[model samples]
Every structure is written in structure tokens, then in C-alpha cells.
Target: MQTSKVEIEVDTQRIMGTLASPDTGVPGVLFLHGWAGSQERDLQRAREISALGSVCLTFDMRGHAETLSQQRYVTRGDNLNDALAAYDALAAHPSIDPNSIGVIGSSYGGYLAAILTSLRPVRWLALRVPALYRDADWDVPKFSLDRKDLAEYRSSIVSANDNKALDVSRRFRGDVLIVSSENDDLVPHAAIASYRSAFINARSLTSRIISGADHALSTPESQKAYDSLLLGWFREMILGAR
Candidate 1:
């Protein structure tokens, strides 16, 4: 396999991405990181997936890490735009098989992935602890969770929860996977449950909940479990395993 660091221009900004591919030219998988995450943070998982014979491209979301700018992380739509732009860049790459594109997103990225499936020809989607609903119990900073901000967030959450985008997913048609942590504190189980309900009702969807994992799934045991589940799912769905 070969690995390279690349950047694609989106609007006036440049987004950083890492590409890993097998020599045999397999399908491409795009990984979108959550809020404040960087492509480097997902290198381990990207390399692991690449070893399974699929190209993996992971990039930083707007206002995070290498893509960070003066712009604030204010809304989901902005992040979704970044993800779409990255997808366009990957699709245009000479080595990638555009029709076989898959996406895996974590947290905020997971929400964006679900939304993107509605707009793009995403063959497969894997959402890890996705923030499907904005729960009041989550520990958001007071300044960021002010009334005006809260209202905006609530609007976005409601719009998404109402299946406005999932309706689009149903129209586009694709396989869907939802992964959740049973003990996630930051994003409550109820939120993931709501997302699961919405997804299942919208189209064929599979879900798995890690018994003891948290929102980040940062522990060694939890991380390993997530890796195993995700890798196996990607191999089967994107790599054509029986």
C-alpha cells in the first residue's frame, strides 16, 4: 500500500487529507473526523482499513486542526459543506473509484455523513456515536450554549431529526450502519436511539452498541472493539466480502 498527504482547495481555504491505497486499486473510503479533530488522529484506523484492500482518505473538518481558520464552529451546515467538498476532491482524484465511495464519520462527522448520504452516491455509511439529536443534558460550554446559539442548534437538530435528509437517503438508496456506545455521556444513548429509529424507519439499517464504551471510545479495549466492528463492516460492505 502507498500513503501520501494531500490538500484540496475549498473556496478560499485548503483542507488537509491523507490518502492510503492498496496497489490493486480497490474501492475508496472517506473518513470524516469529529469537531476539533484532525486527519492525523485517524491515521491508525486509516492504515488499518487500507490494509483490508480499500483506499482510505481521512481529512480534518472545517475550523478544526489544519483546516482551522478565523471562522467559528457555529453550525452543522458549514461542516457538511466541508465534507461535501472533500468528497468532491476525492472523487476527482485519478486513483479513486468514484462510484464505489463509502464514508465513515464519528460524532459530528457522523451526522454529516448521514446527511451526505442523502446528497451523494455513498455506497456505504458507518456512523460512530453520531450526534443525531441535541440533548440539553450534554455538557456544552455555557457561552456556546447561550439562548440564541441553543435555538440555532435546536433548529438544525430538529431539521435533521425530522428525517429531512434521511428522506434523501432513501431516494438515493444505500447500505447504512449505525454504531453507538452504550455508556456515552457526552452524547446520550437516547440520542443515538432516536437516530437509530429514524434510520431504520427510513431505510435498511444495521446498528451495534458497544456495551461499555463512552462517547469517544478512547480506552484501549473500546477502541479495539470499535476497530474490529468497523473494519469487519467495511470489509464486508465496501470490499465485497461474502
Candidate 2:
């Protein structure tokens, strides 16, 4: 396998990423980092997944890394567009099998990845402690949203029809893997239950909780648990599909 730096143009500005591809054409896996995180966070995991005979991509979403100045101004919609552009760029890679694509997202990235399934052809989806936001603030800067209100909303029961990402999950036909942190305070168990109930049409749904893990998987043991689950799922969902 070989790795190379890549850039994707999104609305005039450019975000950077790394691409890991095998010598032969293979499935593509795109890794989306959490909010406030740069592409570097997912690089090692991407390389590990790529070794499983796949083309993996890890990119910095706008408002992160080189564009940190825009953090306060970047809205969910802008980040969604970044996800779209990254997906397109990955699908277009010469060594990628566009029809067989997988997406792995953490926290904020997981929310965007859920919506991306509705817009693209994704065969496998993996979300780790995915966050949820109300649709009312479509264009509002993410940072400006009331954390108290957001927390209250997440804690309350929400139906699949009432949430955009959950609604998409209802119609998704591919396989899904949802990883919840055992002690995730930011995304409560209710959030995970909400997602679990929304995947009515998925080909398969696998849900697991990382023992004693926090939302960010801050501890090395927690991180190792997540990596193990992810790689095992890829082996079953991505490699097994072949």
C-alpha cells in the first residue's frame, strides 16, 4: 500500500487529506474526524484499514486545521458540503471502487455521515458516538448554538421522522455499525437508542458499547477498543462483502 497527500477544493477554499491506496483497485473508506479535530486524528486508523485491501481517506473538514480561523463561522451546512466534496473526491480516485464505499465518522462527523448516505452510494456506514442537532438552526454557526438547549434536546426522546439524520437512517439499505461509548456524557444512551430505532431498513445493524469509554475515547485502552471494533467490522462488512 502507498499513501499520498491530497487536497480537495470546496467552494473556492481547499481542505487537505491523506489517501492510502493499495496497488489494485479496491473499496474506498472515508474517515471523518470529530468536531475540533483535524484529519491527522484518523490517519493511523486509515492506514490500518487500508492494509486490509482498501483505499482510505482522512481529511480535515473546513474550520479545522489550516482553516481554524473559520471555526466560529462554519455552519453545519458548510461542513456537510465538505463531507460531500470529500466523498466525491474519494469516489473519483483511480484506485477506488466507487460502488463499494464505506464511511466511518466520529461525533459531529457521524451526524454528517448519516446524512451523506442519503446523498451518495455508501455500502457500509460506521458511526462512533454520533452527535445530534436540531434542524431549526440550519444556517446558524455551530458554535453559536445553545449548548443547554442542545443537551436538553438530545436527552429528550425523538422519533426518526422528527430528525433529519434519523429519517435518512430509516431509509438506508446498507449495513451499519454504531459504536457507543459506555460512559459518554456528551451523547447519552438515549441518542444511541434513537439511532438504533431508526435503522429499520438497513441490511444489517450492529451496535456495541466500548466498556468504560468516554465520548472522545481519551484513554489509550478506550481508543484500542474502538480500533478493534472498527477493524473487525470492516473485515466482516467490507472484506466479507467481496
Candidate 3:
């Protein structure tokens, strides 16, 4: 196994990531950390996933980590572009097999991953407490969005046609795994149900909720459970595909 640092240039800002590669001609997995989270959160998991005969890339999105200064100025559009760039870079890696790609995201990252499926080729997708946002503020700074309205929007039932992320979920034909926290205050049950209803076309769909877990999986037990669930799903989706 080879682990190394990588830089992805997104316009003027440079995004950083940790890449774990086993060998040549293997599948690739991209890990997108949530808003206010950094790539370090996914590094260990990326390494473990790579151990399963695949290459894994975990990157820090704009407005986080080294780019913390941009937190107040970054928009969803900017982060989406970062995700695209990271995906492209992983696909172009000499050790990766472009035809077999998987993406795993959490919260804000999950939202971005859903949209990415519509724009890229993803054979497998795993989302952890995927979030939903109103399309009215596509260009506004993420931090500036109204929390009250956003909270209300998430609590209400939304159909696939009415939400960008859910809309892509409806069209996605690949394997999907959605992990939700049972006690997540931020992502209500209504939001999860909306996503469940939207994946009408997914090749296969699996949903799991960690008992007594919160949005962050703050407890050690919850964290372990999440890791196990994700790795098991990857074993089925990634290794089984081989």
C-alpha cells in the first residue's frame, strides 16, 4: 500500500487530500467530508477501504481546513466544483479503474455527492445523514443561509421533483447505502423519508440508523458502528462487483 499527499487545484485555491493506493487497475473511492469537517475525519476510513484492493481519496473541501478563511464566503457551487475536481483527479490516477467508482459522503458532502451522480459516473454511493437545502440560495454563501428557514425546510416533506439532491437520487441507478443517526436533530426523520422515497431507480438500496446516535456520531460506540456499516457495505458493493 502506498499513502501520499495530493493537491487539487481548484481555480486559485488549492484543495488537499490523502490518497491511498494498493496497486494498478483497481476501483477508486472518493470520500467527501461534511461542512465544517476536514479530510482528517475520513483518512483512516479511506486507508481501510483502500486495503480492500481499491484506491481511496479523501479531501478537504473549500471553506474548511487550510481554506478556513473562506468559510464565510464559500458557496455550495464552489464546493460542488471541488468534489468534481477531486473525482476527476482520482479517476485519472494510474492505479484507478475509471469504470468502477464509488463515492461516500457525510451531511453537506452527501448532498454534493447526490448531485455529482447526475454529472459523473458513480457505480456506488454511500451517504451518512445527507442534508437537504432550498434551491433558492444556490449562489449565496453557505454560512449566510437562514437557519430557521433551513430547519423548517428539512422538517417538511419534500418530493424528489422538488429537491435537487432527491431528484438525482431518483435517477441514480447504481447501488446506494444511506446511514442515518436515529437521534439526529439536524436531519429530521422527514428528510430521511424524503430521500428513501426518491431512490425509486437505484439498482439496490440499503438504509441503516444507528441507535442512540446523533448527527455527528459523537459517541465512540456510534462511530464504530458507522465504520463497520460502511466497510461492510463497501465489501459487498466494491469487492462483490469484482
Candidate 4:
């Protein structure tokens, strides 16, 4: 396998990424890490996937890890922009087969992946515990005084609901696989229900809940399970004999 650092221009900002490809030709898989995560944490997964005849591109989201940004988690739209920019970067890679692209996102990254699938049709999507909800249900942290700041948060909530995976399910023309934990604390069970409802309607989705797993699913056993499930799902959806 070979690895290289890459950068892509997104609007005025430049996003950093790492590309891992095997010596022989392979399909392309883009892995988006959670908030505060870097490609380093996903190197193991990338290597595993690359060994399975797929190139893996892992990147730091804007304002996270190596891709530093001025803005924090100001709004959902900000995250959407980052995801789209990453997608564009992956799509433009010279060695990647544009039509065989797939995405795997975890936690916050999962939410972005779900939204991106609706915006851009891909071969497959593997979302690990994606969040889907409106403002009324979400526990948006409050640490602002000015009305404009409060308004931005509220507007962000509204925008999130309007652009939810449920509402955009019909637009996702590819197969989807969702992996969630029964004991997740950060994301409520209701969010999983919402995702299921939407995916069920789409009729091109598969899902699994790891017993006793937490939000991060970081336990050694849980990580192994997740890695196996992700690998199988991607192989079936993107590289299998169809």
C-alpha cells in the first residue's frame, strides 16, 4: 500500500486529506471521521479497506485536527459545506472510479455522510449512528448572550430539520448501511428510529445495532465488530459482482 498527503480547495478554505491506495487498481472509499478526529485515527480502517481492493481517503474536517478553521460548530450548514467539499475532492481524484465511490462516516461524520448521499448520489453509504432530528428534540448547547447568536443556533436547527436525512431519503439513489449502538448516550434512540423510518421507506438500506456498545464504539471488541461489518457492507455494495 502507498499513502500520500493531499489538499483540496473548498471555497476560500483548503482542506487536507490522506490517500491510501494499493499497488494494484482498486475501488475508492472516502472515510470521514467524527468531530475532533483526524485521518490518523482511521489509518487502520483505511489499511484494511485498501487491502480489500479499495483505495481509502481519510480527511480532517474543517476546524478539526490538521484542517484548522476559525469557525467552530456554528451551524449545520457549515458542516454540510465541509462534507460536500470532501466529496468533490474525492470525486476529482485521478485514480478513483467516480461511479464506484463509497463513504463511511461515524457519529457526527455519519450525519454528514447521510446528508451528502442525498446531495450527491454514490455507489454506497455506511453511516455509523447518524443523527437526525429537529431543533425541538436536539439539545443544542447554549453559551451565547446576543440574540443574533441565539438566532443563528435556532436557524441552524431549522436548517438541520429541513435538510434531514428523512426528508431527503428519496434523493439517495444508492444502497445504505447504518451501524448503531444500543447503549449510545450522545445520540438518542429516537434519532435511530428516525433514520430507520426514512431508510425503510427508501427500500435500499440495511442496519445493525451492536449490543452494549457506546456512542464512540471504541472498545476493542466493538471496534473489531464495526470494522468487520463495515468491510462486508462496502464489499457487497461497491465491489461485489452485481
Candidate 5:
């Protein structure tokens, strides 16, 4: 496998990443990590996919890694832009097939990936413990806000995330896999339900709930299970016969 460190500039900001390729034209998979996560989390999976004769890209989102130190702004839209740029860069690679691109996102990254399908040509999507996208109050950081203040603020922070995710499912003619932690505490039931309902029009859809797992997959056993589920689904859905 051939690995390369890469940096892509989106507008004035730069997103750092890694690319691993077997120098094959089979397909390309992009890995999007959760909020506060770096590309290191996806490195092993990326290499495994690369060994399987596909190209893979794993990148740190804005307000993350090197980009975090270089910039002060971090928003969902900005992350989406970074993803778009990364997609373009990967697709442009000589060994990659532009039409055969897949994405795997976890938590906050999953939310961005959901929105990205509406904007890009993604053939397959895998979302792991996706964050609550439709609730702005849930996503944003609350430092010193009191209970009463938080409640009032939450009420006013209207979001179209549900609609956006639903639109992607309705519009994107691709395969989808959603892996959720059975004991997750951060994401609400409604949020997960919204994501499940949105896939009504997907060509293919698969879902799994990891037993005794929380949002982080804290235990080694749970972590192994999550990785296996994620990679196995990718093998079937995106890398079929490759």
C-alpha cells in the first residue's frame, strides 16, 4: 500500500488528511471522524480498505487537528465544505473512479455526511452513532448557560437538519448503513428515528444496534464490534466484488 500525507485548502482554511491507495481503479472511500476526532481514528480502516484494492482518504475536519490551530471558526457548513473539497481531491486522483465514491462518518461527522449526500455524488453511506442533527441546541457548546437560559435558547434555535437528512435519503439513490449504540445517551430517539425514516427511498438500507455500548464504544469488545460492523458493511455495500 502507498500512503501519503495531504493538505487541502478550502477557501482560506486548510484541512489536513491522509490518503492510502493500492494504486487501483476499483473505488474510493472517504472517512469522516466525529467532532474532536482526528484522522488517526480512521487510519487503520483506511489502510485495510486500501489493501483490499480500493483507494481511501481520511481527514481531520475544520476546528480539528492542524486546522484547529490555524482557525477559530467551526460549523457544520464549514465541515461540509471540507468534505466536498476532500471528495473532489480524491476523485481527481489518477487511480480513483469518480463515480464510485463512498463515505463513512461517525457521530458529528455522520451528521455532516448526511447533509453531504444532498450536495455530492455519494454511492454509499455508513453512519455510526450519528449525532442529533436537527437539534441545534444539542450540537452547540453550552459553557455557562443556566438551566432556564439553556431551555429558552434551545427553543429558539430552530433547525432544518431533519429536512436536510430526509432530502438526502429521498434524493440519493445509494446504499446506506446506520450503526447505533443501543445504550447511547447523547443522541435522542427522535433523531435516530428521523434518520431511519429518511431512508425510505434508499436503494438499500441496513441497521445495527451494538449491545451494551454507549456513544463512545468504551469497551474494547464494543470497539472491536463496531469496527467489524463498519468494515463488514463497507465490504458488502461499497466494495462489492472488488
Candidate 6:
């Protein structure tokens, strides 16, 4: 497998990313990081999936990582645009099967990924601690978002809870996987249940709770388990590995 850095422009903002792919054509997977994470955080998963005969694209949102300069300039809507643009660019890769694109997102990324699947064509979906999903319960700091942006985020969340993401996901009859930690303090079981209820017509929805993991899955054993579960889900659902 080989890896390379990439950047795609969504209007003025640049979405920075790392792309990994085998030496042949294969499925495509995109990785989205948590609220304060960059594309590099997902290198391990991208490498593992690429080695399994798939191409992976992991990128930083407008306000994080290599693109930190844009932090104060972007909003939740911009984040959605960045994700959609990333998928459009990734799907066009010569080594990727456009129709077989899957996505894995942690925390903020997971929430965005779920929303993306509702509006886009995603073959498989895997979410980890998908955070701030209920916009009604979330608030962007005044330093991070203006009143207008906050209104938009809250509105999006209301849409999400009203069956926008989940209902839109009904168009995708592929597999879905939701992973949560047993002792997560930030995202409770109720949040997980809400996400599950969103996938009303999924072909399969597999939910797993890490026994001793925290919201971050900090323990070595917990991290290992989380990694294995993600790799396995992509291997079978996206890569078709036996």
C-alpha cells in the first residue's frame, strides 16, 4: 500500500487530507475525525483498510488540523460542504469504485457522516461516539460560531431528529454499524438509541458497546478492540473480504 497527502478546495476553504490506496482499484472509504482532531488521527485505520485492498481518504474539517486558519471562518454548513466535496473528490479517484464508497466518522465526524449518508450515496456507514447529534442539546461556543451559525446548527439538528438523516438513510439499504463505549460520559445510551432509531430501513444495523471504554476509547485494549471492529466492518461490508 502507498499513502499521499491531498487537498481539495470547497470554494475558498481547502480541505486537507491523506489518501491511502493499494496498487490496484478497490473500494473507497473516507474517514472523518472528532471535533478537535485532524486527518492524521485516522492514519492507522486508513492504512489497515488500504492494505485490505481498499482506498481510504481521511481529511481535516475546515477549522481543524492543517486548515486551522479557517477555524473562525467556517460554520457547520461549511463542514457539511467540506465533507460532501471530499466524497465527490474521492469518488472520482481512478482507483476507487464510486458506487462503493463507505464512511467512518468519530464523534463530530460521525454525526456529519450520518448526515452525509442521508444526502449522498454511501455504501456502508460506521459511527463512533457520534456527538452533538441533537442540535437542540448542542451549542457552539460564541468564539466558534456566530448567532447565525448557531441557528443553522440547531436547525440541522432539529431536522436530524425529525427524521431527515435517518429518513434519508432509508434510500441506502446497505449495512450500518454504531459503536459506543459502555461508560461514555459525554454521549449517553440515549443518544446511541436515537442514532439506532434513525436507520429505519437499513439492511443491517450492528451495535457494539466497548465494555470498559470511555468516550475516547483511551485504553490500549479498548482502542485495539475499536480498531478491530472498524477494520472488520469495512473488510466485510466495503472490501468484501472473506
**Candidate with best lDDT:** 3
Superposed Cα deviation of residue 81, candidate 4 (Å):
2.0
Q: Rank by lDDT, descending? A: 3, 2, 6, 5, 1, 4
| TM-score of structure candidate 6 | 0.86
As for lDDT, the candidate ahead, 1 or 5, is: 5
- Against the true structure, candidate 3 reaches a TM-score of 0.98
lDDT of 2 by residue, 119-219 (tens): 99999999999898898988999889999988888887789989999999899999999999989889998988899899999999999999999988999
Per-residue lDDT of 48-87 in model 1, one digit per residue for the tens? 8888777788888767785465335435666677788888
Q: Kindly report which residue stretches of model 6 are placed more than 4 angstroms away from their true locations once superposed.
A: 134-163, 239-242
Regions more than 4 Å wrong, model 4: 67-74, 133-163, 201-203
Which pairs clash in model 6? Answer: none
Residue lDDT tens for model 6, 152-234: 34333233336544455545577899999998876677667767766777889999999999988888999999999988887
lDDT of 4 by residue, 75-184 (tens): 45565677788788777767777778888888778777877777775777888877543434232321122335433432222332354656665457677888888888
In order, how many clashes per candidate? 0, 0, 0, 0, 0, 0
Candidate 5 has an lDDT of 0.76
Candidate 1 ranges with C-alpha deviation above 4 Å:
67-74, 133-172, 201-204
**Candidate 1, lDDT over the whole model:** 0.71
How far residue 126's Cα lies from its native spot in candidate 2, in Å, is 0.1
User: Could you tell me the C-alpha RMSD of candidate 6 in Å?
Assistant: 4.2
What is the C-alpha lDDT profile of model 3 across 11-121, one tens digit per residue?
787899889988753999999999899999898898888888899999999999988999999999999999999999999898777879999999999999999999999
TM-score of 2: 0.98
After superposition on all CA atoms, what RMSD does each candidate show versus the true structure?
4.6, 0.8, 0.9, 5.1, 4.0, 4.2
